[model samples]
Target: MGMSVGPSGGGGGRRRGGSRAPMAEINVTPFVDVMLVLLIIFMVTAPLLVAGVPIDLPDSRANALEQEKEPVQISLDAEGQAFIDDAQVSMDDLPAQLEALRKQRGEDNGDAPQVMLRADRSLDYGKVMLVMGELNRAGLNRVSLVTTGSSDRP
Candidate 1:
């Protein structure tokens, strides 16, 4: 007598018969991780990109002013030395440089460019006034004093 062992089909129907197809679903976990790292790097380096002369500014409770254009930056360090946007300029040459800048910006059309004055807190009042005097002589009358915001505020 012949004895039957069992069903002997290919793969025994336990697995798919054909080769597996390529995976249609994409893995986004790695892509998201890379993007997050790039964002963090930019956040850390953004503030350092602002290049300017450093000086100790006094804190004020006054609100910031609205600006229509990029203002000129004039800084005075603790030694009473003046700088025009990070360039060390002698007090005697301040007017000529300012005048040249004013003319180059075409301020004669009546739209005066604003000037922001930054003076160290330790500087004497007279020194600050002297810079202001130079600004006025250069016909830059619309001036604003730059001060840091008070840290005690909520």
Candidate 2:
């Protein structure tokens, strides 16, 4: 005599007629986890990437200027010492160095390159002005004074 088994009575839950198909849907859980980890790493490192010579910038309420290209950075410390990018430069050599930089930027024909001046808050206004004068004499007229935002004030 032949006997029939019910649906739940089972041959290890296998169907009698057909085999199961492979899963076709993608598993996004691992991809999302990796992406989140990469995002966290970037968030932690982004600020450190904006490295430059440290200087306490003066506070200002002036609106920030729009920039099209990377500007030449000039920094003056509280001791009135000057720096072009990160290298120390003497006041005597500043103008000549700036002129060389201008020429390198191909500003000789037209459209002068911008110079961003960052001066310590403790520096004298005259010292900053002198640097600005040197920059102007070098024909780098497109100058922007870098200052910290005044949002921290009450």
Candidate 3:
């Protein structure tokens, strides 16, 4: 029988540095694929990550204002159900809940706590104003209405 020689010119023998050169080239296709998948997942989930209750916010041409501190989030759904942050509370208890929250944040004696109110687009104007009145009577004077940016410019 005759022996065959490999590319290294060895007679069925292993090369000094081994068969493969430790794979000098890196496979970037998988890396790129994983990165693209992660990007798509983030894009799909980023909108759902917003805190507080979900509601159809009305479009507004008014410019958004910046705040110095984290404001209290109050939401009113289409059914007029009130929520302080994510916890549901009746309209009657809204003031007390806000007071408890203010006391916990050490804002009872300090600067007033800012309030961000999100009301559904389908909610009645009078209902929204009623909640605003409640907030005012609770000593939370600084309030900002949260609305989506309108595509049309005034």
> What is the C-alpha lDDT profile of model 2 across 19-49, one tens digit per residue?
7766799999999999999999999999987
Please give me the total number of clashing residue pairs in predicted model 2.
0
Please give the TM-score that candidate 2 achieves against the real structure: 0.76
TM-score per prediction, in order, is 0.74, 0.76, 0.71
Over the full model, what C-alpha lDDT does candidate 3 score relative to the true structure?
A: 0.86
lDDT of candidate 1 over 1-154, digit per residue (tens): 5554435444434434355666899999999999999999999999987637878999888889998778888999999989888899998888899898677764567655798999999999999999899888888888899999855765
In angstroms, the error of model 3 at 104 is 1.8
Sequence-dependent TM-score of model 3: 0.71
> Candidate 2 regions off by >4 Å?
1-22, 107-109, 151-154
The positional error of residue 98 in candidate 1, measured at the CA in angstroms, is: 0.8
User: Which candidate number has the best TM-score?
Assistant: 2
Model 3 worst lDDT window (10 residues) = 102-111
RMSD of candidate 3 to the truth, in angstroms, is 6.8
Native-referenced Cα lDDT, model 1 = 0.84
Q: Look at candidate 3 and tell me the lDDT of residue 150.
A: 66
Model 2: lowest-lDDT 10 consecutive positions: 2-11
